[model samples]
Target: GDSVTQTEGLVTVTEGLPVKLNCTYQTTYLTIAFFWYVQYLNEAPQVLLKSSTDNKRTEHQGFHATLHKSSSSFHLQKSSAQLSDSALYYCALSASNVGDNSKLIWGLGTSLVVNP
Candidate 1:
């Protein structure tokens, strides 16, 4: 079985501080890609970053994530937290190339709250 794990259920940070949301996974499936999604209140989730390449960092909208296949991890980080960055963040795994049986494994998600 394949699954994603997000250790933090809630995170709060000052407006100018750095924030990290940990995401790790265990999967038996190969040919997998990882994705980070963000959803604001009353909004649909959108892809913030995604990567299939191992050991490379992917970034979007001031946020960054590195996919380390060797470690089975894709941790999200932001150098500076902003008030607008508050949202629910999810880490998901997809095996797009694994035929029709390919499925997505999703984390429970982390809630981020940036304070003034």
Candidate 2:
């Protein structure tokens, strides 16, 4: 079975600094779509980034990340990170052949907190 993995647990940081959250995945199929979903304190989870093509960087909002097929990883990184970047980050995946029924499997949420 395919699966997504991320930097589990809580991540605390200051308002002005760099932050990087790890994301990795495993799939028996060669082609799969990967996504990064972010959830605020009370809002629904929204798609932050996605990748269908291999070895391409996908970014959204103030964050940017790349999907590496060879490494089976898609790690998020941001320079001079902000307080608002603090939220719950989830790594997800869907197989290319699974069609619309293809459901997204998510990793354990990563909680990021920034101090002012």
Candidate 3:
């Protein structure tokens, strides 16, 4: 079984300040992919970043995440936080080798609040 963990339940950052959303995982599965999904107030969750190769960084929009297999982490980072960056972020793990139906384990999600 695989599981994702988002340490911060809530993160607050001033506009223009750097922000990091810590994400870690524990799993025995070999072939896996990590993803960071963001959901705005009233919108469906959208894939922010995805990483399958170990030690490679994935970027989308204004956010970036590096998947470190050695540390089992894929922390999301943004150079500068903006007001529109406020959202609920979820860390998920997917094991593609499990038959034709890949299972995804999702974290409890962290809420990011950007202030002006």
Candidate 4:
């Protein structure tokens, strides 16, 4: 079984400051994909970033993440925080393998609050 974890329950950052959402995962497979999903207030959850290749940086919108297989980490980062960046962020794990149990394992979401 695979699992995703985000150590921080809440993260607060002022506008223009850098922000990072920590994410770690555990999986038996050597190759897998990691995803960062963001849900704004009253909005449905949507993928903000996803890893397509090992150790390669994947980015979307203003966020980016580099999946590190060696450390089993795929932390999402933003160069500068914005007021509109406030959302609930989820770290999830899923494999590209052909299995009936290929469901995504989601972590307890992290609340990102950007202050003006």
Candidate 5:
């Protein structure tokens, strides 16, 4: 079975500091893609980054993550934390080019809080 894991249940940072959110995944199938999704309070979840290619960085909205197949990790990072960046983050896995199933295998999600 394919699965995603996010070790942090909650994270807090001062604005202007850096932050990292750990994500790891396991999959039995080949050709899988990974995604990072962000959802602010009362807002729908939206994709922040995605990568199918190992070791390549994917970034959006000031957040970035790199998928490393060798390590089965896709940890998210930001150079600087902003108060507006506080949100819920999820790491997810999707089967690519080999399945009719469109649903993503998602982690429990990390709640990020940035303070002034």
Candidate 6:
């Protein structure tokens, strides 16, 4: 089965700092979409990024990341990270089409905590 995995445990840092959330995956299907979702405290998870094209970088909000099929990874990175960046991040994957019965597979979740 296809699956995604994110950096485990909480990442704690200062208000103004750089942050990177590691994400890796494995899939038996050749064509699949990778996604990054962010869940703020009580809010529902929102799509932060999505990629179906191989080797192309995708970004959303204040984060940027690229999908590397050869490496089987899609790492999220941000410059001068902020306190607002604190949230639960999840790496996910879905098959090309929704009609294809491609349910989204999610990571275990990574918590980003920022301090002043």
lDDT of 6: 0.86
**Model 3 weakest lDDT span, ten residues long:** 94-103
- lDDT (Cα, tens digit) per residue for candidate 6, span 1-116: 67788999899878778889999998876568888999999999998898888788777777889988889999998877888899999999886553566677889999999888
Query: How many steric clashes between backbone atoms does each model show?
Result: 0, 0, 0, 0, 0, 0
lDDT per residue for candidate 4 within 2-104, as digits (tens), equals 7888957889999999999999988775447788999999999998998858889888888999988879899999999999999999999886565645567
Candidate with top lDDT is: 1
- The order by descending TM-score is 1, 3, 5, 4, 6, 2
Better-scoring candidate (TM-score), 5 or 6: 5
TM-scores of the models, in the order given: 0.95, 0.90, 0.93, 0.92, 0.92, 0.90
- Please give the TM-score that candidate 6 achieves against the real structure: 0.90
TM-score of 4: 0.92
Per-model lDDT: 0.92, 0.84, 0.91, 0.88, 0.89, 0.86
Candidate 6 ranges with C-alpha deviation above 4 Å: 96-100
| Model 2 whole-model lDDT (C-alpha atoms) | 0.84
Model 2 Cα RMSD, 1 decimal: 1.8
Cα lDDT tens digits for candidate 2, 19-94: 9999998877645788888999999999999888877777787788888888989898887778888889998887
Clashing pairs in 1: none
Which lDDT tens digits does candidate 1 get at residues 20-93?
A: 99999998776889999999999999999999999988989999999998788999999999999999999999
Full ranking by lDDT:
1, 3, 5, 4, 6, 2
Q: Identify the candidate with maximal TM-score.
A: 1
Candidate 2, residue 31: Cα displacement in angstroms equals 2.6
Off by over 4 Å in 4: 96-100
Native-vs-model 3 lDDT?
A: 0.91
Screening candidate 6 with a backbone cut-off below 3 angstroms (N, C-alpha, C), the clashing residue pairs are none
